[model samples]
Target chain A: MLRYLVPLIVFLGVAGFLLKGLELNPREVPSPFIDKPAPSFSLPKLHEPEAQFASKDMLGQVWLLNVWASWCVACRSEHPLLVQLSRANIVPVYGLNYKDEPDDARNWLRELGDAYVSSLIDYEGKVGIDYGVYGVPETFVIDKQGIIRHKVIGPVTPSALDNCVLPLVRKLQQATAQTVVKRTEVEGCV
Target chain B: MRSLTVGIVLLCLLVFVPLAFAKEAEYMVADPEMEKTVNEISAELRCLVCQNQTIADSNAPLAVDLKNQVRDMVESGQSQSDIIDYMVERYGDFVRYRPPMNASTMLLWVGPFLLLLIGVVVLVVNLRKRTAVIKNDEDLSVEENERLQRLLAAESSPQVAKRGNSSSQKAGEEKS
Candidate 1:
């Protein structure tokens, strides 16, 4: 009985892992930047080329860094949702206009409605590379301390926003920058 | 005949034209040494857009960009591991064609040998059990041996004639 049972258990364990693997999306490579500080960059604003927008400006605020381009067809799908989210005033959505002509980007916003608090021009896609953005329409939920908490690889649909991003953002918003203090407190106790 | 000639010309153009263009686009770097370093690094890194391909083999825009990134890093005199680490820092270990042996991948590295070990154990146990069963069948106890000797003596006596007669009668009945 033990002999038969052991083989059956091992077979089931392998089968279980394979079944779980079948359900997983292999296309979504997990980002290394999660829980790490957001890569910092200052770039010219799409609307005003003379003016600059920096990532450090978003410190002390829970925000969304959306990597997008006019050329990206998927970005159009998530545009309305982003616009709505921006209007809702729940979280500020900033755009990193990845590898787009300034004119085309501005025109796209004019047609689709601007969803960003400020759209920074990543003309060479340097900032996008820094953010570890492979696919356009990637979204990152960043906390007040400028750490990237979560990343959405593809288009941000309504369900994803409601289920994952919004909840995390709300939680991050509620929490204070007490991590440093908490660490010291634990040290004191120890 | 003229149409056939045109068709042959078209085929030649289709095949050779791309070959010419491909030769031009094949080597992105001029320096052979720099190209070798870039190629080595690219071979280790995965193309994010085309998940199956290494950046060296992929033609996707992102793959090209990554190759150029590798080239730039090579030009700047960074070591191969340093460039790979930079990519890993951005893309995680998934960007690597060869996964590093860490706590997560320790099982992946050791799994085959572990399976072989289990198989050997099972085979040994099964062989031993079979040998034990055969030995038990071959070995007879003292009381059993005595009983066998008594049966042989009884068969050799006049009881054999009686048994033989009974079997012959049964055979005759079957024949009838």
Candidate 2:
């Protein structure tokens, strides 16, 4: 009887793992960049070609770095949500226009309504590669110290924005504000 | 005239086709040693977009980019292991076509062999049980053996013996 139960237990164990795996999105691979410093880049602004944008400029601010392309159909799906989030002014969203023509990216923003603080042009996609972008429409949440907090692969859904993105943004913002206050207090004492 | 024109167009295409292919071949390393290292490393790395294929074999855009990255790294004096380590560091062990043995991958490495061992044990146990049943059926007590022999002796009387001998003779004649 014990011997008979062994196979059933093994089968249930495998089934449990399979059920858990089924709930997981295979494309939602965990990024190694989390808790690590965000990869730095200096690329031209998409709207203003003569101007440039760099990751270092966004230091001491909790921000979203969204990697998008005009050619990516999935970006269209998430565009409206990003626009809504931008309108809320919860967090500053920066766009990395990945591997797209400058004119086409400008045209897309013109049609879709711009949601980013400043869209950076990664024309050669070298920045995207550094960010470990395997697919387009990936988003990263970076903290005040330039450390990456979270990475969301694929389109950002409404639920993801509320549950994952918004909550983390609020937490990081509070943490940074406290740190600023503490720093000022120490400086006054000095 | 139309057929001749078609033939000329086909001839032109044939002549230009090799040139297009030659241009694509330019991405390969100039040094044969470096090319071999790139090939080996590419074969080990999985194509993220085309999950089942190695980067070397996949034509997906991401795969092509990764191949180019590998080629560039190989050309820049990076060791073969360093390139693989960089990819694994970024993409995790999932990027490796052949995952290394570690705590996370222990089940993947051992699950099949464990299953085989269990199957062999079950087979041996089942065969032993079946043989024991057969042996039990064949086993006869001393009293049972004596009863069987007595019954046979009673059945073979003088008249039966005479008839049996005649039947045996007939069977012998048939065999001959």
Candidate 3:
């Protein structure tokens, strides 16, 4: 019994170690960057001098935004959408340059077509905390009323624009126009 | 006001210089109903690449895709079970953070019992071999017994044995 116990103990120890090594639990958490007003952020451009911008400045317009790092492979996949976004003039595309070196971000922008209007260099990831950005390539759609209208946490789909964004932006724009008209009519009555 | 305008223009230059167009936060918005479902399903699925992480915690692209797929399915009127079944069909049992007990997964469920059974059988075999040895030892012949006695006598029959023998003889005379 004692002799068998040694082997059994060893087998149990080995099995425990193997189980620890084979522990395979992977998770994909959705970015908490959804539906929340874009975290207010102010950062300088990675390349241009003496220029800083924040979310407060973009309050009056509807925009599509992406948080990207130069090192993110998935961000590269969506670069073409940014280019088309520029050509389509659908809305301004803002970029949050996440966790990447300034030089690399600039070089990447040059290489992939600088289709973004302004990119905030979040070098130390302070803004990321506010937005709950788990990883790079997260996107948000902010309506003109300073409310987030939609969020796509990964790569963009072409249909997302045609099906979701265009209709939403139209509705928001119509709503804003109607509100202005109602206010003017009230002022005339007074 | 002049300085403010200049400041505004300067800031715009800085911001717009990189983007030919302003890049909006396009994908961060969530539909309330779909968002809840996405969160729920993501919490259940295990990420395959990063062990010890659920799909809700994993930052892997595949995990993100799976979360998106789960969201899509839930939005499309699939029940939680239906969503899980779809995932299991596509990615196999490993996708489930908690796999169900079934005949197909009997090994995962009952592997320790199988090991215990094998261990018991091996232990019994070894114990029987040892018992067989002990039983064989019990069947010593007279010559073998005498040989065993001689070996014991070598150790026991010294001056000490002489004293023990004298004492035994005294006892025998007394008894007589």
Candidate 4:
């Protein structure tokens, strides 16, 4: 009986060990923001609540909304990449600090040379949750139609920005051009 | 009346109701090509902060940073394969959820079948040995029967001899 049980234990132990050692299968599912209106958020400015960033504020134009925080180590690692991305003027890059103090975020921005057009202080992270942020440093690519086009979940890299973002900008521009033509056609009909 | 005032407020609330307001717009996907690459890479990349979640799935800040790194790579005109290779080099294969199969992972592919084969062989050997012992018992019936008869004679010797006396007398008549 023990002989049989010994092999069974060995088999299970080995199988368990192998399973633990195996690579995990992680999926890249589409975020809820795709093809939907951006979630509205009213966050006070990092320094001044008088000039806040709201979801409705990004309508009628394209933009890149990045969620970040000083407490997030990856945000710091990706900071240099954001600096590089600022050079690309495809769309304005804005910051939404997820549950961070204004002073720390300001210091981080100051050190990093302020890549965002303006930073919104989401001290409570409620706004970040509404955006379906699983964590910090998520970036959404928004088109002029106020629809979310793509989401990047991690830090920015120079190559990633050029290869993934520029093409989308081009696509959005093409779409905008078609709309301009349709508008002219509608005028002619009138 | 208070009822009238409440009705007005209710009407106003009904007209401009606030339901579950989800801020879905926080995610702005890039162009199709770039978004595809970025999302793909994020799925493969590990979020160091939440070590378990991939950059594609985790809502953690680290996940976002890793995603931005992938985006940066895409924006810099690097190929998907190259970016992944670079990440692997920097962070080791642990960074990728589905790492490329190689010598290091051979046990993962081949271990289960080997274990099953060993288990089946052990079972077959045990069954064969048990059946062989049963067949050997069938060939020893005569010796076992004699031993059982001797044991009974020793226990009831006097009574059994009187019964055998009549048989002996019959044997003498047969001889004459």
Candidate 5:
């Protein structure tokens, strides 16, 4: 009876775990860059080839670094939302045009309406690789200190933006503002 | 016939010319030792895009880029452990084909062995119970053995066969 019970318990336990695993989405791999410094890169601006943009350039502000390409189908779905967010001016959004032809990317932005403050060209996708971008249209929310606060893989849905991204941005902004106030107070005491 | 030979030569050229020129894109690290290390490390890293394949085996663009990155890091004199640490820092433990034993992955590492142990225990217990049942069946009472021997004798002897049948019937009734 004890032997029978043991096998039955093990079977039920394994079955339960398998059933739970089946419900999980394999694609939703959690990023390890959360709370870590975002990888730095310098590349030419998509519009202005002679001019350059670097991750260091956006060091003092909380921003969104969106990795996108003209060829990505899912990016089209998130384009309008990004455009809306850009209009709202909640946070400055920078773009990394990953492994795309310049003309195609320009045409895509022109037709869809540009939402980025400035889009950088990652012609070889080296910057995208540094950012651990496996899929296109991945977004990283970087805090003012350049730490990656959050990463959203796939298209940024409206709920994801509202519930997670926007709230986090607001919190980081407030934290930065408080830090600024503390610095000024310290200077006054000095 | 001369034209046919020329045509055959042309066909052979068409079939085998590309094969002669088909060189695999070689990603060679300058140092042979470093290249070996890079290969070993890459084989252990899972291709994030192709979940089932290792970075070394996968030809996906991301996998290729990762391999290139590993090669560059190796050439730059970074230790193998450092390179693995950098990858893990960026891509979590899931990026490793062989995940480290930790709280999150403890079950994953131990589950198979635990199941094997359970299987062994259950198998041993089952075998013991079966053997015990067989032993009990074999250890019949002395009276039962005598009765079995009498029934055998009656079957063999013609004179006592009818008497044996009646006596067996009475014995069966008594036993019941």
Candidate 6:
């Protein structure tokens, strides 16, 4: 009886792991950048080619760094939601225009509507690699300290924005603000 | 002269045809030594976009870009482990074709041996139980021995004797 039961128990254990594996999305390679400082980059702005944008410039703000390409179909799906988020002024959304032609990227924004504080042109995708962007339409939520708090691979769906992105942004903003206030209080007491 | 011309054309074909067929490495850097290092590293790294293919084998844009990144790093004189560490740092351990042994992957590395040990134990236990059963079967009870003697004495033919022995064995199995 023990012998018969042991094999059955092992089969169930293997089956449970396989069932869990089936539910997991293979495309979502977990990013190592989470809780790490966001990889810094300085690239020309998409709208104003002469003007440059740097990652360090957004150091004191809770912002979204969205890696997008005009060629990416998934970016189109998330574009409207980003537009809505930008309009609501919840979090400043910055775009990393990855491996796209300047003209085509400009035209795409012109047609679809630009949803970025200022889009940075990463023509060679060097910056994309630095940020460990395996897929386009990946969104990164960075805290005021410039550390990446969360990453949404593929597209930023409405549910993801509501559940994960927004709440985290609000929390980080409040947390960072408290830190700043505490520093000032210490100085005042001194 | 015509034969000479044909020979010359054949010679040219022999030389140039192989050149035409020769495939240049798509992501080759200027340095051959560096390119070899780049390839070795690329083969070790997984292509994030196409999960099955290594960055070395894949022609996907990301793969090509990664290959280029490897080449650049190699050119910068960074050690192999350093480059691997850099990739693992950004992409996590998933980027490595050969997963490093870690707390999470300890089971992955050790699992096959563990399974094999379990299989050996189970086999040994089952075999021991079977041997124990056979040992128990060898000792016939007094009533069974009396019945066996009666059957053997009654059976005159060798075939009948064989059948009686088999039937007694079957009875023993049922008892077990």
Q: Indicate the docking level reached by candidate 6.
A: medium
Residue A145 shift from truth in candidate 4, angstroms: 1.7
* Residue A72 CA displacement from its true place in model 5, Å: 1.2
Candidate by candidate, in order, the iRMS in Å equals 0.8, 1.3, 11.8, 11.8, 1.1, 0.5
Model 3, A1-190: lDDT tens digits are 9899988999999999789878742334433333345667778876674688878888778787788988999989988877887888778888888778988999999999887887888876656545645556877777665666565656776776566666665555566623422111222111
**Best first by DockQ, ranked:** 6, 1, 5, 2, 3, 4
Residue-wise C-alpha lDDT for candidate 2, range A22-138, written one tens digit per residue: 988886567777777887889888878899888898898899999999999999999999999999999999999998998999999999999998899988777787788899999
User: Model 1: runs farther than 4 Å from truth?
Assistant: A1-8, A180-190, B1-15, B140-176
- Best-to-worst ranking by TM-score: 6, 5, 2, 1, 4, 3
Q: Between prediction 3 and prediction 5, which has the larger TM-score?
A: 5
DockQ for all models: 0.67, 0.45, 0.05, 0.02, 0.60, 0.76
Q: Give the alpha carbon lDDT tens digit for every residue of B9-103 in model 1.
A: 99999999999888876855579988998999999999998998999999987888888888889999999999998999999998999889999
lDDT of 6 at A23: 92
Against the true structure, candidate 3 has what lDDT? 0.71
Candidate 2, residues B87-113, lDDT tens digits: the string is 877787889999899999999999999
* Cα shift from native, residue B110, model 4 (Å): 26
lDDT of 1 by residue, A63-178 (tens): 99999999999999999999999999999999999999889999999999999999999987777877778999899988899888888889998888887787777778887888
Q: What's the C-alpha lDDT at position B68 in model 3?
A: 65
Give the DockQ-based CAPRI class for model 1.
medium
Candidate 4 lDDT, A114-146, residue by residue in tens: 888888987766566456665567888777777
Tens digits of per-residue lDDT for model 6, A1-190: 9879988998999999999999999788988888788988899999899999988988888899999999999999999999999999988999999999989999999998889999999999999999899999899988898888788888888877776677777777888544532221222111
Per-prediction share of native contacts kept: 0.89, 0.46, 0.07, 0.00, 0.68, 0.93
Q: Which stretches of candidate 3 lie over 4 Å from their true place?
A: A1-35, A177-190, B1-176
By the lDDT metric, which is better: model 4 or model 5? 5
List candidate 6 stretches off by more than 4 Å.
A1-11, A177-190, B1-25, B141-176
CAPRI-style class, candidate 4 = incorrect
Q: Show where candidate 4 strays beyond 4 Å.
A: A1-30, A177-190, B1-176
